[model samples]
Target: MRLQIGPNIDNGRVRLDFRKSPDRPQSTPSYEIEQTKADEFVKKYNSQEKKLFNMTMIFVAAFSMLGWITSIYKRSILWGILGIPGGVIAGLGVGAMISSNKKNNLMDKYNVKEVTKN
Candidate 1:
């Protein structure tokens, strides 16, 4: 069985697809859920994603500022130059980790998964 919870390509509405066989073509979706339920899931997901992105940007800004201040205090150009990329890398890493956990939790809550016959 395969379960999909995301936007539909045709109308951009959140859709839930449940298929008895994983090998079935995309054109055929065995079961479809109500719009309200799918919409709720999509709204939660999008909100979480937005929050993640905002937090990441905040981290980047904070790190960059901290680096700049340190460079000024230490009188080292290297610190200032390294700040931007360092901030970006750190922010992305942190964001990705948090995002993964949140998505997993959300999926679990919604009981969305794929099962294959062995």
Candidate 2:
């Protein structure tokens, strides 16, 4: 059996194709995988979330390091407290990301309809 998955294009739509089985002459139908607004949202949301998360984490780490260094030089712990909020935000972002990612993959979201070959 041959299987092909088309690229996701035009806002998360995919085309699916399958070759007939040999031992049995059963043929799988061809169909287009369409997306709902929810699908579009999920795709866009995941990507944006990743980008924002990374950007936020980078600044957080940088500030945290700066705070640590400043605290050490000044012989005071208060300066290092600046980095604590960044650490907390990073932890919360990680948790939110995990939940947002638990959705069906492309294959699971689609179905097949038989096409008559010319």
Candidate 3:
């Protein structure tokens, strides 16, 4: 028996053919592995949430400190304290809005489709 080896471009799989045909037919199993679209989408969504949360926290702290600087410059500590709640509210609102929109977009894009029977 001679060994023949060549590439088959028709199918992505490498072909392994024998020089002599087998007396009995052979059955091979095939597998279909799915892509990582679902996992990737989830990971991306989580990453976005984490990043946004961290950024929001940092900005809130910075804005509050800015109030202290303003008070020092103007010689009034009470004004600095008054700016705290406003900074926090603005930070929280903006952060929540951004995270919510990103999460919603991801869910809409990667949500599994369902079939209903009437």
lDDT of each model, Cα atoms only? 0.62, 0.50, 0.52
Regions more than 4 Å wrong, model 2: 1-36, 77-118
**Between candidates 2 and 3, the lDDT winner:** 3
Off by over 4 Å in 1: 1-37, 114-118
> Clash pairs of candidate 1?
none
Candidate 3 scores a C-alpha RMSD against the true structure in Å of 19.1
Candidate 2 global TM-score: 0.34
TM-score of each: 0.58, 0.34, 0.49
lDDT of 1 by residue, 1-118 (tens): 3355644434333456543565776665322334556666656766676777787778777767776777778887797788667767877777778777887788677754433332
Which residue pairs does candidate 3 place in steric collision?
none
lDDT of 2 by residue, 1-118 (tens): 3345544556466554543455434445444455443345334434555665665566567656665666677775665665456555655565456533532233344343334331
Best model number under TM-score: 1
Q: Which digits, one per residue and each the tens of the lDDT, describe model 3 over residues 1-118?
A: 1222223323342222224456523542221111334345434654675687897787777776766667777776677677776667767777778776876676567652222221
Clashes of each: 0, 0, 0
